[model samples]
Target: MTVQPIIFFPDQRLKQICAPVIEFDNALRTLTVDLLDTLRAAPGIGITAPHIGINQRVVLLDLPQSNMPEIYINPEITWLSDNKKQNEEGSISMPGISAPVERSVTIRFCYTDLYGKEHTEEADGLRSICLQHEIDQLNGIFWIQRLSALRRTRLLTRYKNI
Candidate 1:
Protein backbone atom coordinates (compact mmCIF):
# COMPACT_ATOMS: atom_id res chain seq x y z
CA MET A 1 0.00 0.00 0.00
CA THR A 2 1.16 3.49 -0.78
CA VAL A 3 0.81 6.57 1.35
CA GLN A 4 -1.17 8.90 -0.87
CA PRO A 5 -0.62 12.62 -0.68
CA ILE A 6 -3.46 14.49 0.97
CA ILE A 7 -5.05 17.34 -0.98
CA PHE A 8 -4.88 20.73 0.70
CA PHE A 9 -7.71 23.04 1.60
CA PRO A 10 -9.09 25.22 -1.24
CA ASP A 11 -8.62 22.32 -3.60
CA GLN A 12 -11.83 21.85 -5.60
CA ARG A 13 -11.71 18.09 -5.23
CA LEU A 14 -12.07 18.40 -1.45
CA LYS A 15 -15.38 20.14 -2.02
CA GLN A 16 -16.87 17.51 -4.28
CA ILE A 17 -19.59 15.13 -3.25
CA CYS A 18 -17.86 11.81 -3.77
CA ALA A 19 -19.48 9.08 -5.80
CA PRO A 20 -20.46 5.87 -4.07
CA VAL A 21 -18.21 2.85 -4.41
CA ILE A 22 -19.93 0.63 -6.96
CA GLU A 23 -17.36 -2.11 -7.56
CA PHE A 24 -15.41 -3.80 -4.82
CA ASP A 25 -12.37 -4.55 -6.92
CA ASN A 26 -8.64 -4.77 -6.27
CA ALA A 27 -8.23 -1.07 -7.03
CA LEU A 28 -10.79 -0.15 -4.37
CA ARG A 29 -9.05 -2.49 -1.93
CA THR A 30 -5.70 -0.91 -2.75
CA LEU A 31 -7.16 2.55 -2.29
CA THR A 32 -8.48 1.57 1.12
CA VAL A 33 -5.08 0.33 2.24
CA ASP A 34 -3.40 3.41 0.84
CA LEU A 35 -5.88 5.61 2.69
CA LEU A 36 -5.12 3.84 5.95
CA ASP A 37 -1.41 4.19 5.43
CA THR A 38 -1.73 7.86 4.55
CA LEU A 39 -3.93 8.60 7.54
CA ARG A 40 -1.54 6.82 9.87
CA ALA A 41 1.42 8.62 8.39
CA ALA A 42 -0.35 11.93 8.84
CA PRO A 43 -1.05 10.83 12.43
CA GLY A 44 -4.73 11.66 12.07
CA ILE A 45 -7.48 9.57 13.58
CA GLY A 46 -9.78 9.71 10.55
CA ILE A 47 -9.74 10.34 6.81
CA THR A 48 -11.85 10.19 3.65
CA ALA A 49 -10.98 9.35 0.05
CA PRO A 50 -11.72 12.92 -1.04
CA HIS A 51 -8.87 14.01 1.18
CA ILE A 52 -6.57 12.50 -1.41
CA GLY A 53 -8.54 13.82 -4.44
CA ILE A 54 -10.45 10.57 -4.95
CA ASN A 55 -14.14 11.23 -5.50
CA GLN A 56 -15.25 8.07 -3.76
CA ARG A 57 -17.38 7.78 -0.65
CA VAL A 58 -14.84 5.97 1.53
CA VAL A 59 -13.69 6.73 5.04
CA LEU A 60 -11.03 5.24 7.35
CA LEU A 61 -10.77 5.75 11.07
CA ASP A 62 -8.38 4.56 13.76
CA LEU A 63 -9.61 6.06 16.96
CA PRO A 64 -7.18 6.71 19.76
CA GLN A 65 -6.13 3.53 21.56
CA SER A 66 -7.59 1.30 18.85
CA ASN A 67 -5.21 -1.25 17.40
CA MET A 68 -7.01 -1.68 14.08
CA PRO A 69 -8.39 0.81 11.60
CA GLU A 70 -12.05 0.86 10.62
CA ILE A 71 -12.93 1.18 6.94
CA TYR A 72 -16.31 2.53 5.82
CA ILE A 73 -17.08 2.30 2.12
CA ASN A 74 -20.05 4.25 0.81
CA PRO A 75 -21.08 5.02 4.36
CA GLU A 76 -24.29 6.80 5.21
CA ILE A 77 -25.53 8.01 8.55
CA THR A 78 -28.95 6.56 9.17
CA TRP A 79 -29.56 8.06 12.59
CA LEU A 80 -28.15 10.77 14.80
CA SER A 81 -28.54 11.46 18.49
CA ASP A 82 -30.15 14.64 19.82
CA ASN A 83 -27.30 15.17 22.23
CA LYS A 84 -24.36 17.16 20.94
CA LYS A 85 -20.66 17.30 21.77
CA GLN A 86 -17.82 19.62 21.01
CA ASN A 87 -14.59 18.01 19.94
CA GLU A 88 -11.40 19.55 18.65
CA GLU A 89 -11.33 18.75 14.96
CA GLY A 90 -8.58 19.09 12.38
CA SER A 91 -7.96 17.99 8.83
CA ILE A 92 -4.82 16.72 7.12
CA SER A 93 -5.69 19.00 4.22
CA MET A 94 -5.71 22.06 6.44
CA PRO A 95 -2.79 21.53 8.78
CA GLY A 96 -2.05 23.88 11.70
CA ILE A 97 -5.74 24.72 12.02
CA SER A 98 -8.19 23.11 14.39
CA ALA A 99 -11.30 24.01 16.34
CA PRO A 100 -13.98 22.53 18.53
CA VAL A 101 -16.78 21.46 16.22
CA GLU A 102 -20.17 20.56 17.62
CA ARG A 103 -21.64 17.30 16.34
CA SER A 104 -24.00 14.52 17.28
CA VAL A 105 -22.76 12.61 20.30
CA THR A 106 -23.87 9.34 18.78
CA ILE A 107 -24.65 8.12 15.29
CA ARG A 108 -25.80 5.01 13.49
CA PHE A 109 -24.41 4.34 10.07
CA CYS A 110 -24.28 1.60 7.45
CA TYR A 111 -21.35 0.81 5.22
CA THR A 112 -19.82 -1.89 3.05
CA ASP A 113 -16.64 -3.78 3.66
CA LEU A 114 -13.88 -4.27 1.12
CA TYR A 115 -15.34 -7.63 0.24
CA GLY A 116 -18.76 -6.04 -0.48
CA LYS A 117 -20.32 -7.20 2.77
CA GLU A 118 -22.54 -4.65 4.47
CA HIS A 119 -22.67 -3.75 8.16
CA THR A 120 -24.45 -1.29 10.37
CA GLU A 121 -23.24 -0.01 13.72
CA GLU A 122 -23.62 2.75 16.27
CA ALA A 123 -20.80 4.79 17.73
CA ASP A 124 -20.30 7.23 20.60
CA GLY A 125 -17.56 9.45 22.03
CA LEU A 126 -14.51 9.96 19.86
CA ARG A 127 -15.55 7.23 17.49
CA SER A 128 -18.76 9.09 16.91
CA ILE A 129 -16.94 12.32 16.26
CA CYS A 130 -14.53 10.73 13.82
CA LEU A 131 -17.30 9.03 11.88
CA GLN A 132 -19.33 12.20 11.61
CA HIS A 133 -16.28 14.14 10.54
CA GLU A 134 -15.25 11.70 7.84
CA ILE A 135 -18.80 11.23 6.57
CA ASP A 136 -19.12 14.98 6.24
CA GLN A 137 -16.05 14.91 4.03
CA LEU A 138 -17.74 12.30 1.84
CA ASN A 139 -20.62 14.74 1.53
CA GLY A 140 -18.37 17.63 0.60
CA ILE A 141 -18.49 19.27 3.98
CA PHE A 142 -15.23 20.56 5.36
CA TRP A 143 -14.52 20.50 9.08
CA ILE A 144 -13.90 24.22 9.06
CA GLN A 145 -17.44 24.74 7.84
CA ARG A 146 -18.62 23.57 11.24
CA LEU A 147 -17.10 26.62 12.89
CA SER A 148 -18.73 29.97 13.36
CA ALA A 149 -17.92 32.62 10.80
CA LEU A 150 -15.67 34.52 13.19
CA ARG A 151 -13.90 31.39 14.32
CA ARG A 152 -13.48 30.18 10.78
CA THR A 153 -11.99 33.47 9.70
CA ARG A 154 -9.57 33.55 12.60
CA LEU A 155 -8.43 30.01 11.98
CA LEU A 156 -7.95 30.54 8.26
CA THR A 157 -5.98 33.69 8.94
CA ARG A 158 -3.78 31.94 11.42
CA TYR A 159 -3.25 29.02 9.09
CA LYS A 160 -2.44 31.31 6.23
CA ASN A 161 0.30 33.03 8.24
CA ILE A 162 1.78 29.69 9.21
Candidate 2:
Protein backbone atom coordinates (compact mmCIF):
# COMPACT_ATOMS: atom_id res chain seq x y z
CA MET A 1 0.00 0.00 0.00
CA THR A 2 1.07 3.56 -0.64
CA VAL A 3 0.30 6.96 0.80
CA GLN A 4 -2.61 8.68 -0.78
CA PRO A 5 -2.89 12.45 -0.85
CA ILE A 6 -5.15 13.86 1.86
CA ILE A 7 -8.35 15.37 0.57
CA PHE A 8 -8.62 19.12 0.89
CA PHE A 9 -11.55 21.13 2.18
CA PRO A 10 -14.53 21.63 -0.12
CA ASP A 11 -13.89 18.13 -1.47
CA GLN A 12 -17.31 16.53 -1.49
CA ARG A 13 -15.85 13.23 -0.37
CA LEU A 14 -14.74 14.77 2.92
CA LYS A 15 -18.35 15.63 3.60
CA GLN A 16 -19.62 12.11 3.15
CA ILE A 17 -20.85 10.05 6.05
CA CYS A 18 -18.77 6.94 6.39
CA ALA A 19 -20.25 3.46 6.60
CA PRO A 20 -19.26 0.92 9.16
CA VAL A 21 -16.52 -1.49 8.29
CA ILE A 22 -18.17 -4.88 7.92
CA GLU A 23 -15.26 -7.21 7.38
CA PHE A 24 -11.82 -7.81 8.80
CA ASP A 25 -10.34 -8.91 5.50
CA ASN A 26 -7.74 -7.94 2.95
CA ALA A 27 -9.45 -4.79 1.84
CA LEU A 28 -9.64 -3.59 5.39
CA ARG A 29 -6.01 -4.51 5.94
CA THR A 30 -4.98 -2.71 2.81
CA LEU A 31 -6.93 0.35 3.82
CA THR A 32 -5.17 0.38 7.16
CA VAL A 33 -1.82 0.20 5.43
CA ASP A 34 -2.73 2.93 3.01
CA LEU A 35 -3.88 5.06 5.87
CA LEU A 36 -0.61 4.46 7.64
CA ASP A 37 1.34 5.39 4.58
CA THR A 38 -0.78 8.44 3.98
CA LEU A 39 -0.47 9.58 7.56
CA ARG A 40 3.25 9.18 7.52
CA ALA A 41 3.53 10.82 4.15
CA ALA A 42 1.38 13.71 5.27
CA PRO A 43 3.65 13.55 8.27
CA GLY A 44 0.53 13.98 10.32
CA ILE A 45 -0.38 12.37 13.60
CA GLY A 46 -3.90 11.36 12.56
CA ILE A 47 -6.14 10.62 9.61
CA THR A 48 -9.67 9.32 9.32
CA ALA A 49 -10.33 6.64 6.73
CA PRO A 50 -13.41 8.34 5.33
CA HIS A 51 -11.43 11.48 4.53
CA ILE A 52 -9.73 9.53 1.76
CA GLY A 53 -13.10 8.72 0.12
CA ILE A 54 -13.25 5.13 1.36
CA ASN A 55 -16.31 5.79 3.55
CA GLN A 56 -15.14 3.17 6.02
CA ARG A 57 -15.01 3.67 9.78
CA VAL A 58 -11.31 3.64 10.52
CA VAL A 59 -8.71 6.10 11.72
CA LEU A 60 -4.93 6.01 11.44
CA LEU A 61 -3.17 7.79 14.29
CA ASP A 62 0.52 7.91 15.20
CA LEU A 63 0.56 10.64 17.89
CA PRO A 64 4.04 11.67 16.81
CA GLN A 65 5.34 8.22 17.55
CA SER A 66 8.60 7.32 15.95
CA ASN A 67 7.66 3.72 15.32
CA MET A 68 4.43 2.54 16.94
CA PRO A 69 1.47 3.98 15.11
CA GLU A 70 -2.07 3.16 16.26
CA ILE A 71 -4.83 2.22 13.90
CA TYR A 72 -8.44 2.35 15.04
CA ILE A 73 -11.27 0.82 13.00
CA ASN A 74 -14.91 1.63 13.61
CA PRO A 75 -14.01 3.71 16.61
CA GLU A 76 -16.56 5.09 19.02
CA ILE A 77 -16.42 7.47 21.91
CA THR A 78 -17.74 5.70 24.96
CA TRP A 79 -17.14 8.36 27.60
CA LEU A 80 -15.77 11.84 28.15
CA SER A 81 -14.66 14.17 30.90
CA ASP A 82 -16.74 16.96 32.34
CA ASN A 83 -13.81 19.31 32.46
CA LYS A 84 -12.62 20.82 29.22
CA LYS A 85 -9.29 21.99 27.91
CA GLN A 86 -8.53 24.56 25.26
CA ASN A 87 -6.15 23.94 22.41
CA GLU A 88 -5.31 25.06 18.91
CA GLU A 89 -7.41 23.19 16.38
CA GLY A 90 -6.69 22.86 12.69
CA SER A 91 -6.99 20.21 10.02
CA ILE A 92 -5.43 19.05 6.79
CA SER A 93 -8.97 19.18 5.47
CA MET A 94 -9.07 22.92 6.12
CA PRO A 95 -5.61 24.27 5.80
CA GLY A 96 -4.17 27.75 6.55
CA ILE A 97 -6.17 28.42 9.67
CA SER A 98 -6.01 27.53 13.33
CA ALA A 99 -8.44 28.32 16.10
CA PRO A 100 -8.50 27.90 19.81
CA VAL A 101 -11.28 25.69 21.09
CA GLU A 102 -12.28 23.85 24.21
CA ARG A 103 -12.52 20.06 24.10
CA SER A 104 -13.11 17.28 26.56
CA VAL A 105 -10.20 16.47 28.78
CA THR A 106 -10.57 12.72 28.64
CA ILE A 107 -12.36 10.34 26.32
CA ARG A 108 -12.96 6.63 26.39
CA PHE A 109 -12.69 4.97 23.03
CA CYS A 110 -13.59 1.57 21.65
CA TYR A 111 -12.59 0.17 18.31
CA THR A 112 -11.49 -2.94 16.46
CA ASP A 113 -7.95 -3.43 15.32
CA LEU A 114 -6.49 -4.85 12.11
CA TYR A 115 -6.58 -8.31 13.72
CA GLY A 116 -10.33 -8.01 14.41
CA LYS A 117 -9.67 -7.79 18.10
CA GLU A 118 -11.68 -5.27 20.05
CA HIS A 119 -9.96 -2.78 22.31
CA THR A 120 -11.00 -0.06 24.74
CA GLU A 121 -9.08 2.70 26.44
CA GLU A 122 -9.28 6.21 27.80
CA ALA A 123 -7.21 9.02 26.38
CA ASP A 124 -6.40 12.55 27.46
CA GLY A 125 -4.59 15.65 26.20
CA LEU A 126 -3.68 15.73 22.51
CA ARG A 127 -4.70 12.11 22.14
CA SER A 128 -8.25 12.97 23.07
CA ILE A 129 -8.29 15.82 20.59
CA CYS A 130 -6.88 13.58 17.89
CA LEU A 131 -9.49 10.93 18.61
CA GLN A 132 -12.28 13.48 18.59
CA HIS A 133 -10.97 15.08 15.42
CA GLU A 134 -10.76 11.78 13.58
CA ILE A 135 -14.21 10.80 14.81
CA ASP A 136 -15.59 14.08 13.49
CA GLN A 137 -14.16 13.27 10.08
CA LEU A 138 -16.09 10.01 10.07
CA ASN A 139 -19.23 12.05 10.73
CA GLY A 140 -18.57 14.29 7.74
CA ILE A 141 -17.71 17.31 9.87
CA PHE A 142 -14.64 19.53 10.08
CA TRP A 143 -13.28 21.58 12.94
CA ILE A 144 -14.34 24.77 11.26
CA GLN A 145 -17.87 23.48 11.13
CA ARG A 146 -17.88 23.62 14.91
CA LEU A 147 -17.13 27.30 14.92
CA SER A 148 -19.61 30.07 15.50
CA ALA A 149 -21.26 31.71 12.53
CA LEU A 150 -19.12 34.79 12.89
CA ARG A 151 -15.95 32.74 13.11
CA ARG A 152 -16.97 30.49 10.24
CA THR A 153 -17.84 33.49 8.09
CA ARG A 154 -14.51 35.05 8.91
CA LEU A 155 -12.79 31.81 8.05
CA LEU A 156 -14.56 31.50 4.73
CA THR A 157 -13.76 35.10 3.93
CA ARG A 158 -10.20 34.49 4.97
CA TYR A 159 -10.01 31.48 2.69
CA LYS A 160 -11.13 33.84 -0.03
CA ASN A 161 -7.65 35.36 0.57
CA ILE A 162 -8.21 38.27 2.88
Candidate 3:
Protein backbone atom coordinates (compact mmCIF):
# COMPACT_ATOMS: atom_id res chain seq x y z
CA MET A 1 0.00 0.00 0.00
CA THR A 2 1.29 3.41 -0.93
CA VAL A 3 0.98 6.49 1.24
CA GLN A 4 -0.74 8.86 -1.11
CA PRO A 5 -0.14 12.60 -1.15
CA ILE A 6 -2.75 14.49 0.84
CA ILE A 7 -4.65 17.27 -0.86
CA PHE A 8 -4.67 20.05 1.72
CA PHE A 9 -7.64 22.18 2.69
CA PRO A 10 -8.97 24.83 0.26
CA ASP A 11 -8.28 22.47 -2.65
CA GLN A 12 -11.26 22.33 -4.96
CA ARG A 13 -11.21 18.53 -4.93
CA LEU A 14 -11.66 18.57 -1.15
CA LYS A 15 -15.00 20.30 -1.62
CA GLN A 16 -16.31 17.88 -4.23
CA ILE A 17 -18.88 15.50 -2.85
CA CYS A 18 -17.48 12.01 -3.15
CA ALA A 19 -19.15 9.42 -5.33
CA PRO A 20 -20.24 6.08 -3.91
CA VAL A 21 -18.11 3.04 -4.43
CA ILE A 22 -20.04 0.64 -6.66
CA GLU A 23 -17.41 -1.98 -7.46
CA PHE A 24 -16.11 -4.00 -4.54
CA ASP A 25 -12.99 -5.09 -6.31
CA ASN A 26 -9.21 -5.15 -6.04
CA ALA A 27 -9.01 -1.46 -6.88
CA LEU A 28 -11.26 -0.67 -4.00
CA ARG A 29 -9.16 -2.85 -1.74
CA THR A 30 -6.05 -1.05 -2.90
CA LEU A 31 -7.61 2.29 -2.18
CA THR A 32 -8.43 1.13 1.31
CA VAL A 33 -4.85 0.06 1.92
CA ASP A 34 -3.56 3.30 0.55
CA LEU A 35 -5.89 5.25 2.76
CA LEU A 36 -4.79 3.37 5.85
CA ASP A 37 -1.17 3.89 5.01
CA THR A 38 -1.77 7.52 4.32
CA LEU A 39 -3.61 7.98 7.58
CA ARG A 40 -0.93 6.23 9.57
CA ALA A 41 1.71 8.40 7.95
CA ALA A 42 -0.45 11.39 8.58
CA PRO A 43 -0.26 10.39 12.25
CA GLY A 44 -3.96 11.02 12.37
CA ILE A 45 -6.88 9.09 13.77
CA GLY A 46 -8.94 9.30 10.59
CA ILE A 47 -8.87 10.19 6.91
CA THR A 48 -11.10 10.12 3.84
CA ALA A 49 -10.61 9.42 0.12
CA PRO A 50 -11.19 13.01 -0.92
CA HIS A 51 -8.33 14.10 1.32
CA ILE A 52 -6.07 12.33 -1.15
CA GLY A 53 -7.98 13.58 -4.19
CA ILE A 54 -10.01 10.38 -4.67
CA ASN A 55 -13.61 11.50 -5.00
CA GLN A 56 -15.05 8.21 -3.79
CA ARG A 57 -16.77 7.51 -0.52
CA VAL A 58 -14.13 5.90 1.70
CA VAL A 59 -12.64 6.50 5.14
CA LEU A 60 -9.93 5.05 7.35
CA LEU A 61 -9.98 5.44 11.11
CA ASP A 62 -7.78 3.94 13.81
CA LEU A 63 -7.83 5.48 17.21
CA PRO A 64 -4.64 4.71 19.10
CA GLN A 65 -6.61 2.55 21.49
CA SER A 66 -8.15 0.38 18.77
CA ASN A 67 -6.62 -2.93 17.76
CA MET A 68 -6.61 -2.01 14.10
CA PRO A 69 -7.71 0.52 11.56
CA GLU A 70 -11.25 0.43 10.17
CA ILE A 71 -11.99 0.86 6.49
CA TYR A 72 -15.46 2.12 5.67
CA ILE A 73 -16.75 2.34 2.13
CA ASN A 74 -19.81 4.41 1.35
CA PRO A 75 -20.42 4.95 5.05
CA GLU A 76 -23.54 6.80 6.12
CA ILE A 77 -24.77 7.79 9.52
CA THR A 78 -28.00 5.93 10.24
CA TRP A 79 -28.77 7.33 13.67
CA LEU A 80 -27.51 9.81 16.24
CA SER A 81 -27.98 10.10 19.97
CA ASP A 82 -29.95 13.02 21.34
CA ASN A 83 -27.09 13.79 23.67
CA LYS A 84 -24.13 15.72 22.31
CA LYS A 85 -20.43 15.66 23.03
CA GLN A 86 -17.62 18.00 22.20
CA ASN A 87 -14.25 16.76 21.01
CA GLU A 88 -11.20 18.36 19.51
CA GLU A 89 -11.04 17.51 15.81
CA GLY A 90 -8.18 17.88 13.35
CA SER A 91 -7.65 16.83 9.72
CA ILE A 92 -4.99 15.17 7.66
CA SER A 93 -5.71 17.63 4.86
CA MET A 94 -5.48 20.60 7.17
CA PRO A 95 -2.78 19.57 9.54
CA GLY A 96 -1.74 21.23 12.80
CA ILE A 97 -5.06 22.79 13.67
CA SER A 98 -7.94 21.61 15.81
CA ALA A 99 -10.99 22.81 17.70
CA PRO A 100 -13.72 21.32 19.80
CA VAL A 101 -16.71 20.38 17.65
CA GLU A 102 -20.08 19.33 18.94
CA ARG A 103 -21.44 16.01 17.75
CA SER A 104 -23.66 13.19 18.84
CA VAL A 105 -22.25 11.23 21.74
CA THR A 106 -23.27 8.04 19.94
CA ILE A 107 -24.09 7.08 16.38
CA ARG A 108 -25.19 4.14 14.27
CA PHE A 109 -23.74 3.82 10.80
CA CYS A 110 -24.00 1.55 7.78
CA TYR A 111 -21.13 0.79 5.51
CA THR A 112 -19.83 -1.70 2.96
CA ASP A 113 -16.66 -3.64 3.53
CA LEU A 114 -14.03 -4.47 0.97
CA TYR A 115 -15.64 -7.82 0.35
CA GLY A 116 -18.92 -6.13 -0.55
CA LYS A 117 -20.65 -7.16 2.63
CA GLU A 118 -22.82 -4.48 4.23
CA HIS A 119 -22.40 -3.87 7.94
CA THR A 120 -23.98 -1.67 10.52
CA GLU A 121 -22.21 -0.65 13.68
CA GLU A 122 -22.83 1.54 16.69
CA ALA A 123 -20.08 3.69 18.14
CA ASP A 124 -19.47 6.22 20.88
CA GLY A 125 -16.75 8.49 22.24
CA LEU A 126 -13.75 8.97 20.00
CA ARG A 127 -14.90 6.37 17.49
CA SER A 128 -18.22 8.13 17.12
CA ILE A 129 -16.58 11.52 16.72
CA CYS A 130 -14.00 10.29 14.23
CA LEU A 131 -16.59 8.49 12.10
CA GLN A 132 -18.73 11.58 11.94
CA HIS A 133 -15.72 13.69 10.99
CA GLU A 134 -14.63 11.32 8.23
CA ILE A 135 -18.12 10.94 6.85
CA ASP A 136 -18.36 14.71 6.73
CA GLN A 137 -15.24 14.78 4.57
CA LEU A 138 -16.84 12.28 2.21
CA ASN A 139 -19.85 14.60 2.05
CA GLY A 140 -17.66 17.58 1.16
CA ILE A 141 -17.74 19.05 4.66
CA PHE A 142 -14.33 20.11 5.88
CA TRP A 143 -13.62 19.63 9.54
CA ILE A 144 -13.00 23.33 10.08
CA GLN A 145 -16.57 24.01 9.03
CA ARG A 146 -17.64 22.24 12.17
CA LEU A 147 -16.14 25.06 14.21
CA SER A 148 -17.82 28.34 15.01
CA ALA A 149 -17.46 30.93 12.26
CA LEU A 150 -15.05 32.99 14.29
CA ARG A 151 -13.01 29.96 15.19
CA ARG A 152 -13.04 28.71 11.62
CA THR A 153 -11.75 32.04 10.33
CA ARG A 154 -8.98 32.24 12.90
CA LEU A 155 -7.92 28.66 12.30
CA LEU A 156 -7.82 29.06 8.53
CA THR A 157 -5.75 32.15 8.87
CA ARG A 158 -3.37 30.28 11.15
CA TYR A 159 -3.24 27.41 8.68
CA LYS A 160 -2.42 29.76 5.85
CA ASN A 161 0.37 31.34 7.81
CA ILE A 162 1.81 27.91 8.43
Tens-digit lDDT string for candidate 1 (1-162): 899998999898888899999999999989989998999899788989999889999999988778898889999999999999888999999988889999999999999999899999999989899999999999999989889999999999999898
| Clash pairs for candidate 3 | none
What is residue 115's positional error in candidate 2, in angstroms? 1.6
Q: Which candidate number has the best lDDT? A: 1
Error of 3 at 2 (Å): 1.0
In angstroms, give how far residue 65 of model 1 lies from its true place. 2.6
Q: Indicate whether candidate 1 or candidate 2 has the larger TM-score.
A: 1
The per-model lDDT (C-alpha) reads: 0.91, 0.83, 0.90
lDDT of 2: 0.83
Candidate 2 runs further than 4 Å off:
65-67
Candidate 2 residue-wise lDDT, 1-162, digit = tens: 887777887788888878988899998888888988887776677888866768888998888643688888889999989999888888766667778767899999899988789999999988898899889889887778877889888888887782
lDDT by residue (4-49, candidate 3, tens digit) is 9999878989888899999999998888898888888988889888
Model 1 Cα RMSD, 1 decimal: 0.9
RMSD of each: 0.9, 1.7, 0.9
Models ranked on lDDT: 1, 3, 2
